[model samples]
Target: MALNPPSPTPSMFRKKKSSSSLGPMSTAASYLSAVRAADARARARGDTPLTTPALSLSSSVTTSSEDTILDEGEESYSDILTYPSIPPTSEQVYTTVHSEFGHCSNEEYRAVSQHPAGKPVAPHVEQDPPYYVLFTTYISYIILILFGHLRDFSRKYFNPGEFKHLVPHDGYAPITSDFDSFYTRRLKGRMDDCFSYPVTGVAGRTIVLLERESKDSNRTFAPTGRKVRTLNISSYNYLGFAQARGGCADAVEECIKRYGVSACGTRVEGGSLDLHSQAEGLVANFVGQEDALLCSMGFATNSTIIPALVGKGCLVISDELNHASIRFGVRVSGANVRMFKHNDMKDLEDLLKEVISQGQPKTHRPWKKILLIVEGLFSMEGTMTNLPSILELKKKYKFYLFVDEAHSIGALGPHGRGVSDYFGVNPRSIDILMGTFTKSFGAAGGYISGSRVIVDRLRVRSHSHTYAEAMTPPVLTQVIASMASIMGVTPALPTSTSTGTITKSRMPEPEVPEAYPGRALSSSLPTWMDLPPAMREGTEGRDRLRRLVFNSRYLFRGLKKLGFIVYGHDDSPIIPLLIFNPGKMSMFHRLMRQYSTPIVVVVVAYPATPLVTSRVRFCVSASHTKEDIDTVLRASDYVGDVLDLKHSDGERWPLERIMNSAVELVQMEQPSHD
Candidate 1:
C-alpha cells in the first residue's frame, strides 16, 4: 500500500521551479531514468542478496558496517555492509568508508525535500495503540508506584536514619521533601542503567560504547574496560559530520594548533576572534539573513538571546512543546507567556486573537511587542511546526516570529536551509532564526540570525554575547568547514545585493537553482581553512542530504509496514517509533543492543513524552546505509513480535519484502489528504 505522489494544487507550495544543481534534484542520471533502472533492478533480481542478512548475532560480534572489515581474512568477498545487497557495478567508485559513512551510490534513492508545488503541508497525526496496551502501560506505572511507596513506608519505620536527608538535618532545613524525589528514587533509579552510558570515539555511523555494569540497582557504574562498536541512531549527528578524520577535522586541528583552546573573555570584552565575525557572516548568508550573532553554547543561544529580544511589556506566544531552554529564556525575559497546543494553528490563532484583543492584563494598555516562538522541528515528538499556516497568520497578526531551528537547520529542506526553505517561505519573513551547531555541523554552539539592526542590538544586549565566552577557534573552524562543504564555494561577481553584507569571491559556485537557498559566499570563510574537492564542489553535502532523507523515510516506512506506531513526517530525520508500554521500552532497548548487529538505541519515556506514548527515537543519519535501515527494521520486527508491540494501524509487510523493495518504497510519495 505505497502512497501515491500527490498532485500539485494551488496554495502555499509554489510550482516546481528549475532545480538547483547544488543538491536535491541533481542525480547521476535523470530521475525518470533512475526510477526505471531501479524498478528494473527490483523486478529482475533472481538471487540477488536475498532479504536481510542475519541480525540477531552475538553481542560480542562487531557492528554491521565493520563486519566486512573484521572478517577480511576469513572472506575476501563483500558482506552486508560494504555494498549492501546490490553489488556496485564496476563503473562506481566510492571514496568514503563503509563504517564512517555508508557506501550508498544509488541515484534513485533521493527526492526533493520541499513541499509539493501549490499543495498545503499536512500536520502530524498521532497514532493510537490498542486499549490493552494502554491499560498495561498505565498498570505497570501503577504497580511501580505502589511498590515504591510501600518500600519507602517500610524504610521510614525500620531505618529512620535513612530519612535523615528528608528530616531537618543538623541546622539547615530538610534538603527536600521525600515526595519531591519520589519518581527519581523509584522509577528512574530502576532504569538508570539505560541513561548516560559512557561512550568513546566518533558518534558517526557506528559509535564506540564503553561497556559498564551496575550491580546495586543502578546506584553506580564501573566500566568493564570493553568497547563495543554499535550501529548508532542515538546521537544528533544528523548529516554525519561528526568525524574525527575529515577535511573539517583537519581544519579544526589546524585551528587548535594555531589559536589553542579557550576564547578567554566574552565577545563584548577582549575575547572576540576574527573567526567569529567570519562564521557569523557565513551563517547569515546560509540562512539568507542580513546579519547573524553567535553564542558559545547551544542552550545559551535561546536562554540569553531571547531575553535581549523581548522584555517586561512584551507577550511571548510559545508552542506548549517548546524545548526547556526556550521556557527558561521566556521566563528570564519577564514577558507574559501563553501556550497553545503543539502545531495546532487554529488553537494558536484563537489564543493570539484573545491576547491581542485583551492587551496587557491589568491596565488594558497596548503591549510593546508580541513574539511567536516555535521550534522548527520538535526533538521529542518529531513534529515540524506548521510554518506555512503560521506565516499566513503572521501577515494578519503582525507578531514578530522567532523560529528555533535547533534540529531543523541543515537537516531540513532541499538546500539544508531549514523549515522556511522546506515550506518555500522566504527566510527574511521570520523575525529571528535561531539554531545550534551541535546537531548538523558537528560543532559546539548556537546562533541567532536576523536583520542587521536586530543582530547589532543583540550583540550589545544579549547576555551570552556580553557575559559568555566567544565561540572558540576550533568550533568556529569546524562550523566553517562543514557549512562551507554544504554551500560549496560561491563564484566571484562583484554584484552586491541591497543588504550590502555580500562578499566577493574568486572560486566558482555551482549553478544553484533559482529556488535554492542562498549559498555561503567564499569570502565568508577564513582563507586559511582548506577542504576536500567533494566538499568544495558541494557533492558530499548533497549526498549526505540525499542519504539522510532516504534513510529517514526508509526507517519510518519500514517501521510502519512492520506495524509499529510512528510519529513525525517521513522526511524529518528524527523518527520516533512508538513502544507505548513502560516495561516494553527498556526491553526494546536491551534487545536491540543485544541483537546480532548491536544497534544502540535511545528509549524515551514519561517526562520527555506523554506517559503512555513512551518510545524509542531513531535519529537517522546520512552515515547509515540502506542495509543499515533494513537491519534496524529486521531488529524491530523481531523485538515487536516478542513484546507484542506491532499494534499500529497499517498494512503489514514481512521484513524481507520491505528490505528488497527499499528503493521503490523510498520513491513512493505520501498521498495528500486534501
Candidate 2:
C-alpha cells in the first residue's frame, strides 16, 4: 500500500497578545486552552487526536487624531521595517512547507494602530501638498505592505488550490546531479524503447488483450526504425478470448439474439436469469464442485467472501504473499489475522500449532475451525503453490482452507480446472474455492465454489453479490460458453474424463492416500507444468507454466547475449533489466520515448526501492514470439553497450569494499567508544 498523507505542522502559530489593555490576550489563546482541555478529556477517554490548533491574535485598532502630529526627525515604524533609500529587489526563493490555517496582520496594520499592549499609535501624519495626496499616499503604501505580507503568508502555507509550478524548463538548475540523472535516464530509456519491444501501433512487443479501453486506447502508433505500435502489458486477458473466439462469438451472438446485452438489476431483484445460473453451474461443473455463487468481478469474489466467512472468533491464517485484494478483504472481516511466510509449510505448521495450543482454552472448539488461505499460483513469482504438501499439512492439522484460483483456472490441472485438478485432488476437498473470469476466460466476474450449504450461505451472505448488480448477460454467456468449451461440459463431452479427472500411464505413481475424500480417481496426472509426456519428476503446475518460464529465459538469455544485466526470476516472465548507473530515470524515459518499445522502468530512490536495485522491469508474455523477444533484447543490448556499462550477472563485485568501509568507520570511532 502507498504511504499515508503527511501530518500538518505546528510552526504556523502566531503568539497572541492583548488587543485591549482591559481584556485578556487574543481569542486565539482561549481557543488553544479550550483545545488543550478537550485533548486532556479525550486522553482520559483513551482517544488521541492527530492535529491540534495553535494560538493566534485577534484584530483591533485604537488611535487618536491628536497623535497625528509626529515629532520632526523621528523615524517611522515603516522605516524600521523597510529601507526606502535602498531599492527593493527579489530575494532568494527556497521551497518550504507551509501552513494554511494561520493569518497575521502586516506592518501597515501596525503602523497607524494601537499596539497589542494597547498603547496608542499615530495616525497618518502627512502634510500633503494636495488634499487628495495626503490620504492616497498613506493608503497606497499601507495596501502595498499588506499585499506583500499576505503574499509571504500564502507562500508559507499549503492552500488546497495553491500548488507549486514545478517546471523543468531548459534554464532551470536541478537540486542534485543524482536526481537529475535519474529522471534523465528514464526519459532517455523511454525514447529509445528500452522498456518495450517494436510493434505496429504499439511500442511494446506483446499485444495486451484488453477487455475495456483505457486512456491510451487511441495511441496505437509506434515508429521505431523498424516501425512499431503500442502494446499494453497490464491486460488481464490470458486465454485469448477477447479476440473473438469462434465459439465464444457464437455464444454472445446467441445471448444478444435472445437476452440483449444486460439483465438490468440486482440479481436478487429482476436481474436473475438462466444465463447467470448457467454460468454458475458451468464454473462449479468445471471445478467438479457441488455449487458456485457468481459475482460481478473476481476482485469482489474474494473481497466479499473472506469477510463473510470469517468473523471475530475466527482466526485467519493467510500467506504473507497473498494478493492485495485478499489482504483488504481480511481487514474488513474483523477476524484475527496471522501472517505465515510465503510458501513456507514450516511457518504455516508452526502457526497452526501455536493457534491450537493458545486458542483451545478460550473456545469450545479445538482450533479446527481456523481458516487457512493461499493463492493457487503466486502472480509475481509465477510459482505454483505446493497444494499436495499443503493438503498433507491440512490433513495433519484439520483447518478449513480457502484457495484463490484467480491465475489458475483455465491455465492449470487436467483441462485447466485449477490447482486441485493439477494435483489430481478432487475439488470438493477444498473448503472454499474462488476464481475470477478476467484472466484465461477473457471476461469479467468471479465465483466461489464449495458445498451446497456454503454456496447457499454465500448467496444470501456474500456482500458483493448481495449488493452489486449481476453480470451483464452477454459477458456471462461468453464466459459460460468459453468455460464449457474448455472443460468439455456441453456436447464436447466424453473426449474428456468424468468428474474433471483423467487417467495416464506415463509413469510410476506415488502411493495414493487410502480413501482421501474427494481425491480424483486418475491413472495419470497432467504434463503441462512438467516436461511434455515424459513422466518427469518435477511439479504439478510445472508443465502449464513452462511457456512463460521459457519465454522469460529466452528473453534473459538474448538480452544477456547483448550485454545487459537484468534482475528478476529466470523462470518468471516479469524481468527487470538493471540500469544501476542511469543519469536519471527521466533521461531514460526520454531516450525510449521515440523507440517503438513499451517496457516500464521501476524508479529507485532513497525512499522507494534502494539505489542499488534501480532498474526497469521487462515483462515477457506468451504472446511474444521468438523474433519479438530477440528485438527487445537487441535494443536493450544497444542501449547498455552505448552507455558502456560493465554488466555482471547481478553482483556489484569487491565484496570487501562495503565491509572495509564499515571497518574503517569502526576504527575511527574506537577512541570515542572507549
Candidate 3:
C-alpha cells in the first residue's frame, strides 16, 4: 500500500495572525508573508528562528529600504503596502522563500502562516481555504518522511545477516556481502597475510623481504620495517628475464624518450603510435600467428574479445578450471555454456556428444556456433592442458578453440613458444591465441594473436579496442625487447641455443633416501649440485626452464615426504599445498611465517578454490637457486611436523614409487594415435 501524509490536528489552526499585516497578495508575496509569520510565531514559542543571518534571502529578494518606512504625514494604503515594479523570476522566488522558511516547524506553519493576510488570523478557523496549492505542499513533505523511514528499515532489516558480522554496530556499514567483505572479513586476516609480501630489492636469488602474521598484537612479523634475506619463491619471473639489467630495461628507456608515457586514447583515436604496431608485429612473429592485437590490460583482452566473437545463439564449451576472466567473457557474450571436468577428456567427450545430439536448449535447432575455451596451464593447479586430446575433440565437434596462455607464454615448451610448442601441436589448429605480457615478458599489457581475419575483426568490433585507452609506449617497448631476448636476437644477451653443457658433477641423486630424523637439518651442501645434468645443460632460456622444472620437482617431492598433500604435476612450476580445514589453513599460514626461514606463498581459499580445499600456491621461478629451494623445504618440513600435517607413511613413498605413479598418469593422459 502507498503511504500517506498524516492529517493535521485542529489545535494546529488555533494560532492568530499579527496586526498590521498586508492583505492577500500574489503567490510570491504570499510565500514571503507566510515565512515572516512562521518566524514570528517560533520566537513567541521560545524556539530558534528558521533562518539565521548567514542564510538571509535579502541578497536575492532585492527589497528597497524605503519600503519599510512609515509615512507620518499620511496614513494611506500606498505607503503601508509596497510591491516590486518587476516580478521576480520563479527560480528566484522559490530560492528566497525556501532559504528563509524551509527549516520552520510544519505544524507551527500550519497554525499561523496558512492564515489569510491582512486578517486577524486565529489558530482555529471555522472555514478552510479553497485552493489545492497548500494541500499539495503538505503531501510532498509527508512523502519525504516516509521515504526516510523506508530507507532505514531496509538497512536494519532487509540486509543479509552475514553482512552484519563484519560491520560495526552503529556507524555506516556495508549492506551487502561483496568483494570488500569477502577480503576484509573472510580472507584478509589469513590469506592476505601471506600474499604481497613487501620486498626491499629485486626478486633475485635471495630476496630481502618482510613477512606478515595473522595476530592482533603483531599481525605482521616484520613490524619494525626491517627486511630479512629469504628465499624468493612467490613471483612469476620465468625465464629469469624480469630482472635483466641492460636488455629490456634499456629498450623501454629509449622508447620512453622517443614517445612520452602514454598513447593518450583508444587505438583508433589519437593513441595509436608506431611503437604499438611494432610490438604487435613482434608478438605475432614470436607466437607464429598471422597478426596480433594488443590491449591495455591482459585480463581485458580475453574479457572483451570473447564477447565480440560470439554472443546469443552460440555455445561455449569450457574447462571447469578456466580463469575467471574467461568465465566473465562467456557470461558477457550471453552464450549458452557447459563446463567439463578439469582436464578430463572422457567427460568432455561425453558432454559434447550429448549436446550435439540434443541441439540448442529449448529449441530443436542447430546453434549459430560453438566455441571451446581452455587455459594453456591452470595457474592454480599447475597442470598443463592435454592439448592433443582437446584438439582431437575439437575436430570431432567442429568447434572453434580459444587458449589463454597467460602463464605458459614464456615459461613452457623447449623454446618457450607456449603449450602448442610444448606438446608439438600445430599452432594453426587453435582458432584463438591469447596471452599476457605481464608474466614472463615483465610488461603491463596483453595480446590476441590469431588469423588475419580475426585480428581485423577485433580491431573494429572489440569494445576494448574501440573504447579503452591504448597500451602505453614504455610497456609496448618492454614487451618487444623481451620477445627479442627470447628469440635470441638481442646482442646484449646470449643466443637461445648457445650455452655450455651440464657437467657430470651436477647430476641429481638417482635414489631417494630413507626417512631420517635429521634429513632437513643435515642438508648443508647446495641442492642445485644434485639436479640432473639434463636440467643444468642448455641455452640460457632452456636452462632457466629446466631449473624451474627441477625446483618444482624438488619442492613437490620434499612436501610429499613431509606428509603434506600437494596438488598438480611434478613438471609444473605451480605447486599447491592442500590444507582442507579452514582453521588448519589459517594455522598453517601463520606457522609458515614464524619458521626460521620465512617464505611468502600465495594462499587460495573460498571463491577462488572450493571452501573444502583451501591451499597455499607456490610459483617456482627459474630465478630461485637450489639453496633457496632447500631453505623453503626445510622450513616446510619443520612446520608441517609441528602442525601434525605429515602422513604416517609419507616418508615410505620412495622416488621409484613416485616415478611409477607419474608414468601411470602420463599414460592415462596420452591420447591413442591409432
Error of 2 at 278 (Å): 1.6
Model 2, span 513-543: residue lDDT tens = 2232122222221111111111122121222
Q: List the residue pairs that clash in candidate 3.
A: 13-123, 13-124, 14-123, 14-124, 15-123, 16-121, 17-121, 508-530
Instruction: For candidate 1, write residues 455-572 as lDDT tens digits.
Output: 9999899988887877778888999999988888764455544556776454454433222365566667777776766677787787788778888888888899999889888888
Worst 10 residues of 3 by lDDT: 106-115
Clashes of each: 3, 75, 8
**Overall lDDT per candidate, in order of appearance:** 0.77, 0.49, 0.58
Cα-based RMSD of the predictions, in order? Answer: 10.4, 32.9, 34.1
Ranked by TM-score, the better of candidates 2 and 3 is: 3
- How far does residue 652 in candidate 1 sit from its true spot (Å)? 1.5
Provide the lDDT at 246 for model 1: 67
Model 2 global lDDT (CA atoms, 0 to 1): 0.49
Candidate 3 wrong stretches, greater than 4 Å: 1-174, 178-192, 195-197, 204-206, 210-223, 262-271, 490-539, 648-674
lDDT agreement of model 3 with the native: 0.58
Which candidate ranks first by lDDT, i.e. highest? 1
